[model samples]
Target chain A: MSSTILLQSIGFGITTAAVVAIGAMGFTLQLGVTNLLNLSFGNVMTIGAFASLIAEHWHLGLAATIIAAPLAGALVTFVLARTLFALFARRQGGAFDLLMVTLATGLIIQYTIDALAHLQVFQFSFPSGSTLNIGPFVFTVLSLSLVGVAALVLAALLAVLHLTRIGKALRALSVDPKLARACGVPMRRMINLTWIISGALAGLAGLVYVTNSLTVDASAGLDFLVLVIAAAILGGAGSPVGAVVAALVVGIASEVVAAVGGSYYSQAAGLGILALVLVLRPASGVWSGPSRDEVTV
Target chain B: MPDQLLRVTGATAGYRGVPVVREVDIAVGASEIALVVGPNGAGKSTFVKAVIGELPLMSGRIEFNGKDVSGWGEERRAAGGIGYVPQTRDVFPTLSVIDNLEVGGFRLSPKECKQAIAQMFERFPALERLRHRKARQLSGGERKMLAIARALMADPKVLILDEPTAGLAPRIAHEVLEDLVVGLAKLGRGILLIEQRVTLASAVASHVTVLVDGRVSYAARGDEFRAVPDVSALFFGSGEAAERSSWSAARGPA
Candidate 1:
């Protein structure tokens, strides 16, 4: 590949990373605090995309569709967490068992969407007003807006985690829920807030993703799930800042590989990074102590 | 005498619907220290858990600040001014000392939380010096002190401690019990302490309750408890017979 082509691929990689970071942030927050490996997260993202699509089909403008997407995502995620996930957690299920439950939940959501949409791919498009060149990289207006959105989301998350009272409660609960409760931190309210915020981010990620990829289907989120998990694990599971950085590395590497090899090998490149990370830092991805068994939600 | 800050009357509680502690009565007045000491499997910790709302009460009433809190959840009880320091994982190890203190004041307003944290730093100078460091990075003594300080951040009416000095050296354990635990009671808050070091605990306790095989083997004021000839016997012997003798000895021709 030529130098210009390589630079262009790198630019595309950064944009892809931006979307991945949004999804990974939410996934890591929920995973870190609850210790629930929610395999259903991707399907929730699909739900968000479909929500946006339906809003648009009803002649709702772009702004309304965008707003509706995250709202739908938050509501569904909150309800499921309060109901289905809470039931399994109360049954004294371990983390691995909860993970399996989430996997089953994801399957159900995927098939439900599949049946709803009659197993057909739907096209999605957002206006790409103009293209801009920054140094050797080129980006469309829509792509830049996506990157801007990611930046805003990260900044907001950082503010919430650092500057707010609820953030302190969340950090404490994430580290030690029992201790947090003993200290008078309300676990239920904090957990409900987590679900809503994380779900909103997941929804936003879905919308941005479809805007870039220009297609939506029941399996779209399922297909993207691997990348989300990879970024989250590579970023040490719970740290949003770490997730963003990891997403950049994964996104750039995959894009570069695709430039050299083919699009089919791009995902494999991302998986290779995940595999290497797991081998090098076993403690990050795998539970090593009895401490992991405690449930917060 | 000051009002009873915490009163447990006939509190029978256990795990998995099986009784581990039976018909235990304990009380802590304002500015008093009530220590629960016993041998292994004596249900000292279980009784503390029961009082703190960690375990369900099979049948009994727990009153805090003159209100019956038997049906309240642990968090609700905490919010009602019960500060508990658990035996293990007492602090959020990954959080900084200041952050740990901040979490402790979760019920406080932002201004009050800041004030409480500042007070903690002044009280625990060691924690102040290591304020930015993680709780896990603190020494054993520092961690214990941090846990106690964190519990106090809520400015609770009653403080419940479960084996605060369990793994500490004899010297450190003595310091924790004497300097910290006793010192807190001196501040006029009721304290319920579960301790393994009978000698150290008995020396400072205003009152003592002894548990053996899931029941209170002996309960008495500090002076009466100190007069007992052998504590090890009370722990090792069949509880009821020894308890009667100890009770008579404690009464002494009344």
Candidate 2:
């Protein structure tokens, strides 16, 4: 491929990376703190996008929808964690069992959303009017805004995780919950806050994704969940900056591949990279997210 | 309150009703170190766990600092000044040394926690140099020291250590025991240690209990026990104590 083609692909990839990073950070944080793969997390993202769509339909501004989606996602995930997941936590569900529980929760959420959206498709209206060109690449105002917003969210999340006292407690709890508890970390509150943060990020990612793609459906977030998980695994789970960096690389590589080849192999290229990383570092590769030892009881 | 910092009376605790530890009564006081020693499967570890609220007491009353803390949850007991370090798996191996200490400082304020961690670093200068390194990379002795230092973060009134020197070189083991006594003496923290090394235990502990087959067979002061040999045999085998005591004494040379 020519350098021009590569450069354009890189620019496009960075934008996609921005979206993926937000989702991956949310995915990683949820898995790290709860020790649940939370397959249902994609559904939470879909809910957020739909919530934003509803807000937009009511003539709310883009900012309002942006705020609305993550809020809605956070609330739902919080309820699930406190009411349903907490029960399973007490039973000491190991890695495999926890995965099943999260998968079930995901099914419940996706179907419930599918029922609400009437099983029909949604073509949500996003702001469209201006297209900007930054020296060889072009993007709409909405796409630019989505990238900007995702970047802001990612920065905010990293700051919260690294700077605050709460963040220290979170990192500790995510490493070893029993030790964290013994040290007097508020287990219940930390668990709840984690759900809120992760769920909200998932929702925001969904909204941004739908805006960029210019379409909405129940499966919007699910279509990209694999990429999010790959980014998280490629980065270390619980490392937000690492996840973002990995997401950027994956997005660019996949886009460059798509630029050269057909779209059919785009998703496959991302998976191939993840497989390569896992093979190279078997222990880190197998360490997809947090295990039960990380979650608070 | 006058005689004890912690008291467990008629305690029977177990895993899933299997009764690993049964009908045990023990007391510990301030400025005192109680050492519980026994062979493997003798349930010394189980009794320590029962006192710390990790294992449910089948039937018992654990009074701590004039309050019945048996019914309290593990976190509550810890917050109220009880600290427990399990035999192994006490430290988060994946996290850094400073981070592990920060985890143990969860109950304290940010300033207080930082101060406690700094104090730990001062006490363990080796850990200070390796503060940024992960616990997984540390040697067994270093890991044990980190676990103890982390448990010390809250300035707990009572510290319970299970087999603090279980598998270490003779010199490292002696260093750990010496560190343990010196550290506790500095804080005046009531210490409860479960040890298999009799000489080490007898050297550091003011009070010692020998648990055999899930019961306390002998409880006496270190000097009192040093004055006799037959009483130590009643719990552990006569020949075993002689071997361990001489080994530790020869190795320790203190």
Candidate 3:
């Protein structure tokens, strides 16, 4: 393949990476803090996108939708987690059982959205703007904004995680909940905050996704979520930096593969890389992410 | 006992309602080190866990700092001036030493946390050098020191340690009990330790309790324990450690 096409695909991949990073960060944040992989994350993303679309229909400015997305995402996610998820967890469910419950919950949400939206796709764009040329690549205002926002958000998250006591408690909780409890880390309060924070990010991920495609529909989130889940797990389920890096690698490879070969293999390409990494380096500490055993859910 | 930091009476606790340690009694005061040593299935760790609120008492009462914290969770107990170090997985292995200390002092203000961390660093010169290193990278003795430092972060009124020297070399285990454990007691906090090394326990322990078949078979002051004729044989004669599984759930195969 020509270098120009490769670079262009890589540029496009950056946009995909940013979206996946946000979603993965949200997913992994909850997974790390609560030790439950909330499979309904994709449905929550769809909810955020729809909330934004509803705001747009009211003729609110784009910024209003931006604010609405995370608000909707956070509220919905927190409620579901605290109510439905907590009930199941208290029933002596193990990590695997909790995962299944999340998966089933996601499907219920998808069906609910299907009925609400009448199984239809709706137009929702970021208002087309002038494109910018950087080196051999091109990007619109929205695409650049997505990348910039991703970088800023990631930086802010990293700072909080490293520099603050709350961050220390969070990291500690994720590593060992029992020990964290012993250390006086308030599990209930911290857990609630985790759901809210991750929920907000998931909502932003929805905005990142729908804003890029300029379309809103029930299946939009579920379609993109496969990649996000892979990125979250492969990134070690708790590290935001790891999630973004994994997202970039997977996103770039998929886009480049689509550019060079059949587009049909793009998703397969991403999963193949994950499988390859898992096989070749099965041990922890080799990668920045924690070992799979450390986080069973 | 007048200045007691911890008191447990008729404490019965186990996994899933099945009794592992039953009807036990123990107490520790400020400047006292209570050593609990027993065979593999003696339920010593279970008793420690019961006191720390990881395992709720099936029956009986636990009083800490004159407050009955029977229904409290581990976090509440910690916040109430109790610190704990488990036999294993005591430190967050992935975190740097400084980070682990930060978590230990989770509720401390910035200034207080900084001061506590500094005190720990000064107290453990080796830890100061390894502050930036992850806990997993430390030697066995260093990890033990780090665990103790982490538990001490909150300046808790009481500290509980479970098998701090389980996998350590004999010399290092000796150093832990002789040097660090003794030094910690000098700080005037009530310290409860579960150790398998009798020689080590005999040196610093102010009190010793021997458990067998999930019961307190023997109890005495530290000097009395050391003065006994055969410490190992006192509990090992039960032969329960070989027949029963240990450290797992008390229930059978669930």
In candidate 1, stretches whose alpha carbon ends up further than 4 angstroms from where it belongs are A1-6, A285-290, B242-254
Evaluation by DockQ, superior candidate among 1 and 2: 1
Candidate 3 lDDT, B1-254, residue by residue in tens? 35888988889999987999987877888989988888888898889889989898999988898888999988899999988999889899889999999999988988999999999999999999999999999999999999999999999888998989889999998899888888888989899988888778777898787888888777777787777787777777653432222211121122
What tens-digit string does per-residue lDDT give for candidate 1 at A218-237? 97877777788889888875
Question: What tier of docking accuracy does candidate 3 attain?
Answer: medium
lDDT of 2 by residue, A1-297 (tens): 898888888777877888888899998888777667888788888888899989988888868877988999899888888877778877976667767888888878777778887887878776665988887787667667767886787789878876776887788777777777777778788988999999899888888777776677787777677778888888877888788988998888888888999666668767887888888876673274334554452
Docking class of 1: high
Flag clash pairs in model 3.
none
**Candidate 2, residue A288: lDDT:** 45
**Where does the lowest 10-residue lDDT sum fall in candidate 3 chain A?**
A288-297
**Cand. 3 TM to true fold:** 0.93
Per-candidate DockQ versus the true complex? 0.82, 0.55, 0.78
- Ranking of models by lDDT: 1, 3, 2
